[model samples]
Target: MGFFEKYLTLWVALCILVGVTLGYFFPDGFQFLGQIQIAQINLPVAVLVWLMIIPMLIKIDLKALSGVSKFARGMGVTLFINWAVKPFSMALLAWFFIGYLFRPYLPQDQIESYIAGLIILAAAPCTAMVFVWSNLMDGEPHFTLSQVALNDVIMIFTFAPLVGLLLGLSSITVPWDTLFLSVIIYIVIPLVIANSWRSLVLKQKDGDEKLTDLINKITPYSLSALLLTLVLLFGFQGIQIVTKPIIILLLSIPILIQVIFNSG
Candidate 1:
C-alpha cells in the first residue's frame, strides 16, 4: 500500500474535520454546490464517484472473471456475505435501533430517511476500498478483482430493487426513479467506460507495464477524488450534523456491527 492508503483513516478524519469546519463557516458555498443535481443525483458527486471508482476498476482483468472457479471457497463466502447477508442484516439493525430503540432520541422526521440511507449504504457492495483492504490483508489480487467484478455485475442488477424492498419493509417510501438513475449513472456507465479504457490500454505495446504505470500515476488522484467527495457530503450535511452530533454516532452503531459481523 502507498503512504496515503496506509494512513487513509487519518486522512479521512482530517477531511471530515476540515469539511465540517468549512460547512459551519461557509454554509452558503456548500449549499450552492448541493443544488447542482439532476435526477436527484448530485452531478459533482457522480463525477467524483466515477473518479474514485474507475481507477480501481481499471486494475481488474475482465478475463479473470472466468477464474472464479479457482477460488470457489473464498468467492462463495464473499457472495454469501455481500449479497445474502449485509443488506438484510443492516436493514434489521436499522429497524431495531433507528426504528424503535433509538426513535425517541433521533429526529422523528428523519428516522425513515436514516433507515433508508443505511439500507442503501449496506446494499451497495464494496468496490474501490475493497482493493485497498484486500491489499492490506495480503489477499490474492486476482480473486479480489474477480469477486469485485462479480459484485459490480450483481449490484447493477439488484441495487435498486434490494434497496426498494428494504425501504418498503421499513415503511419508507421508495423513490424508484431516483434509485434506478443512481444505479445506471454510478455503476453501469463507469463499468462500461473503464472496461473499454482497460481494453485499449491492453492492446498497446508493453501494455502490462504501461497499465501499471498509469494506475500508479492515477491512484493518488482517485483517492483525492474520494476525499473531496467526502468533504462535499459532510459539508452538505454539516448543519444537521452540527445540531445533532449524536446522529452520526448512533447511525454508526449498526454499520460497525454489520462490519464486525461480516468480518468475523
Candidate 2:
C-alpha cells in the first residue's frame, strides 16, 4: 500500500468498533484478556508497546543527534510544556471541573480514584508515541529524539515527586529504580539496538534506503498492535465512562488540553 493508504485514525476507529462489538457479544472473553496481568502491565498491551516502540526506534538518526544545538527551541518548548506547565494545569483543571462543578454529580468517593488515574496519565513522560506525532507534524526528528532522551533522564529523578505533589496524594508512590529500568528497556535499549543494527548492516554500503524500506514494511503490524491495545483499554473503561460522563469528562479535561496545546 502507498503511504497515505494506511491511515491510523481510520484503523483505530475500526479497532474500536470491533472491540466494542466483541466486548458486547463476548464480555467474558475480553474481560479475561484484561484480567490477565502479571503486574500493572497487561500481556496484550505489552506486545503493543514493543511493536509500537521498535518501529519508531528504527527511524531515529543517531548520527544527526550530534548537532543537538540546531533544534534547541523545539526541545525547550516540549520540556517546558511537559514539566513546567502540563502537570499543574492538569491538576488545576481537574480540581475545578471535577471538585466543584461535577462533585455533587458523582457517586462521591470514586472521584478521587478517577482523578488519580488522570494524574498518573499526566505524570507519565511521553515516550514511544511522541516520535510518531513529531514526524507527522514535520518536526525535526533528531531534535525530538534528543529531547526525549534528555526528558527520560530527568524524569528518572523527577516523576514520583512531581506527580505526588501535583495530585496531593501523599501515599502516591512509584518504583523509581524500576521506572528507570523501564526507560532503559523501552527507549535506551531500543535506540542502541536499532542504531547498532543499522550501522552494522548498512554502514559500508549505501543502503539507508533499503533499511528504511524494510522497517516500513513492519509498520502495519506495530500499528495493528497499538490499535488492538487502544480498543482493549477503552473497552474496559467504557462502562464506567457511561456511568459518569460529566465527571469523567471534567477530570480528563486537563489531559486533553495538554495533548492539544503541546501537540499543536
| Per-residue lDDT of model 1, residues 167-249, tens digit only | 77644445566656776777678778878888899899998888889877776777788799889989888877787789888
Q: Which stretches of candidate 1 lie over 4 Å from their true place?
A: 108-113, 126-176
User: In model 2, which range of ten residues has the least summed lDDT?
Assistant: 38-47
Compute the lDDT of residue 260 as modeled in candidate 1.
95
lDDT of 2 by residue, 40-125 (tens): 55666655666765666677677777898977887788788888877777777677766677788766888777676666677677
* TM-score for predicted model 2 compared with the true structure: 0.82
Best by lDDT: 1
Q: Hey, what RMSD does candidate 2 come out at?
A: 3.1
lDDT of each: 0.81, 0.71
Q: How much is 175 displaced in model 1, in angstroms?
A: 4.0
TM-score of each: 0.79, 0.82
